[model samples]
Target: MAFVSSERIIPISDGNGLEGGGAFLPITPTPNDVWNGWAHSGAWIIQNGFNGGGKDNVTSAPSQAAQNSVTVSDPVTQHTAADPVDVYTGAFLYDGPGLKVGNGEAPMALDYRPHYSTNWRLQNTAKIGYGWTHSYDIYATERHASDVDIHTASVAEIAPYWVTAQYLLDTVTKIPTAKEVALRVIAARWATRQVLKAKVTVALGERRIEFHRLSDGSYMSPSRFRVALEKSPEGVFTASFKHGNSIEFGGPNAHASKIVDQYGNECTFAYADDGLASVTDAYNRTLTFGYTLGALSSVTDSTGRSVTYSRGSTFDMVDADGGVLSFEMDTYGHQEILSVRDGLDRVVVVNLYDVFHRVWAQQPLGDALKPTYFGYAPGLAHETDAWENPSWTKFDSRGRRVQTVDMLGNVATWV
Candidate 1:
């Protein structure tokens, strides 16, 4: 059978917390100076790129698409000469740090981040076309960031004009009471539906679609669309593309989850648990899995960082080869081998942070086994060998040593 272990983290705040922000203390694993390196480790992962393998380079996930890149077209607009319909459409993608699990045949991959760029163009009948590209990159622990952009002009006229307005309804849990939502510039209604409750009706061309939220009184946001419908002579009914109208449902959390890397600001594990999707923090930074596990095991956000929990927790052991294994974390917060020839052999313990984006781990050998220096890089980037020394080996991407020599001449860095 599969042996499982899990982690949970929550916040603790006092009313007297600082303004513009509230202090959050970790609530688990009896947090003490022993685990003080958590945040420093998180920064390491953001900077050096987490996975042992260096495949997650800056351009690993480079994505490029021109209007004609996918399906080339220069269709004229449906506007008259007076209005002179000029359609303008642009494609943009904001790719963040993503994890690529190994198939064993390949090396384990983590924090593979590429620059996120938005490419857009605006055009009208009077002009040819113009477009611009903006790109952003985070360096050194998902904190340090820089961006470079290139603006270009095009000889081809921009795509014809088209307008799309999306109306979003959030889960009832999100809206405290009577919250007013505005659907600005309602163009020709394409489709609508109540995602959480059938009582709500969304109409497209001329029919209505039923939407519902979870039984727990959660309201389905506009993004949690089920189907598009319209009000008919008799009642709300479903509609097809008979009049060039179409309906499509947006995935859950499609809109609410986004990480903004604004200057002088840092955030991690920002997401919505609406059964939709998860979002990373501003720097796409995270710690090791071990660290995350530790945090979750105690259900306390010791770093007082932000995190989003999507669902309940379950424990599962995985082997180095990426296969399911039989190992467990004992009540005392140590890993035990369930199927080993020797009963309950000591194993590695993992703690996670930044919503499991970063991980930290340690062997259950007790404080005596603690390393002189806690290695940097989100969690334990080097599981090949147990961290054993307080050596100053971490260097910046530019090969500059990051370990600061403290007052006692002790050079160290903590996350």
Candidate 2:
């Protein structure tokens, strides 16, 4: 017989902050007992009758779908050519199909999985076929489980005539609400999903601008000062930057793009079958890159300056003039420490970081190390070097850093 260690046991909380939701004493599950006996047991003994869990030895559990159906108070209206219908964007629960687990020889137990469906109109115009239907698969068990693991799928269809409404909205001058801005942003993001390497023209009053998505998840615009979007794997825009006056994505290869500035200066990129080979800039200067065993080996800059890199325990790079730069990475692939050296390999600058990968201090070669301290509130940094100089930074409700107050009461405001 095997016994589980006391350290391996986890104490589960009851929903009402009281142990077992004021029903019984908290049940601490040992690893061995939880894994071998109650891993997939229909209703946990501790959670029974506390938060919708059925009584002991009950075959059928209560349907969460029938219990928790959310009704939206203010749903959006989807107007069609025939009639306008109300679209619900809130969760409407339903009983999902039973999931078969364990061996086929064993009796199949009913899995009480509750699913929800949310429907919303992506485009507010009178277009008939432009909307989104979102469905989610939610788990019923695990009291501490947040709503994050709810698997969601969004199905959207954009009609050809939908562009007319979008164009009109772009040309019209009106103060949009927070909801309108959020809806428009989601609509723009949805429009670019799965449409890789294709040009789409939109007429905005007298101007016709072409929008296209690259293979590497970037968008090109026909307008001046094109905005380049870097998207994540989920088709969400992570970062956006202004490119030159004109930008075009290369063919099958993602890296072979070109950008031309307002002054007719151009920069072209070339790539090998695997990676980038060289970049020729507007001034006819070339920067070449080299790879070794599928890893970046060297980078030769436009000014004929070269930096060669080697990877082992840490990444070490040496410039052509013998200056060295070494980096130490955390498990999450973030550079925790960066050390810069001179020609003689003497450390010139050292950057340090906290566990969350925030840069806390920087030490120069000849100066005394003055460490910087950061105070965080929720998601934004609220203060920096506050322990030493007593500075306080404040952010707005939108998480934007608004103002900073130093030790001398000097206030700096950001717009």
Candidate 3:
């Protein structure tokens, strides 16, 4: 077993044993400030909301030693889903002792919009508000689309603590779907809010289904606690959470209620399966679940050798039975890989889909709501800090408030 200590950024040492050659310097925090730059300062804001308006929040400054680089940390202090505030950007720079590095004398803008926060967060928020007019080709899965979907252009608004992300989803000529149409709204919000949370509502004509953050803080059961649309209008609507995965239904027939899991696990659900394969819309597909306890399990792999993990539940995927020769859950319990033998035109193929999950914050809808699991600056080391938020900042070297990047992708100047 090999274990190595992790540092935020590799410090550059000049011949004189001094950090040099950059506007931002990666420094190591010493004692007395153990949680200085390392402590989480706020929640993460997601960009996927109703109509594509996604945003996130960040409270602390980036590390000096890790400037222009990514430093995974925790959420801001006292953050939650219903806080009514949004976050768009954050940094991991060093600001010495006081909270503000330059006290608005300088401000660093974080950018580089990517598909998922996980992607850009890992790469560090180095690429800010990029790819608005960039053209790109995307590969589509058989289950998602028939061919590659081309993207034309996209744009976003860059803010000190907020960002507004926008993307022109379709490059090829085609009318957008309700989902696509809705993304526009989400995109708009994501562009502006610092931390953005949205309730995704699916409207199948008069029959509409909606999903939002587990706001109520009551998580007795994932299945039992959910908001329902008794009478959905032709347009879209957002719902509110009460507690424990429970929701308050709106409209005339609306009532405070909850939902039960697929397998009937009431509260304190446990994940119990890997995954299974089937057909959907007359095409081959797979359904992965968010592991909940005692949901369902199957044996596959000819000899039935496999590993499995635990999760809340699986998303629905419709496919044919024969195409799926076997199924087994990996040791992880949350994901299960399916082996489709000869189903791919005599080609042995395996397709895996990972299930995503969300945990609601334990706060009243009336409170400043936030998600427990996700927040702006969400990462392996990031945590939320609601007590003292990052109102603004300034970089050290240039003594300028605004940080400008050089052609070489370096922090060119702290203006």
Assess every candidate by TM-score: 0.19, 0.40, 0.18
> If both were scored by lDDT, which would come out higher, candidate 1 or candidate 3?
3
lDDT of 1: 0.23
- TM value for model 1: 0.19
Task: State the C-alpha lDDT per candidate.
Answer: 0.23, 0.36, 0.24
Candidate 1 vs candidate 3, TM-score winner: 1
Candidate 1, residue 301: the lDDT equals: 19
> How many angstroms is residue 154 displaced in model 2 relative to the true structure, after the best TM-score fit?
18
Q: Which clashing pairs does model 2 show?
A: none
Q: Per-residue lDDT for 137 in model 3? A: 9
lDDT of candidate 3 over 1-415, digit per residue (tens): 0112432322222111233222111133333322222222222222335122233332334345325632223222211121211122221111000111111110111011112121122221111111100000011111111121123111111221123222543422277788876776676654433223223333221123433222231111123335442223532222333432222222222221222233332211112232212101111111222223433222122122322322223212112243322222234543322222233433222222212212112122212333221122111111232333222221332122232222222342221
lDDT of 2 at 105: 12
Off by over 4 Å in 1: 1-36, 41-162, 165-188, 191-344, 348-358, 364-415
RMSD of each: 25.3, 24.5, 25.2
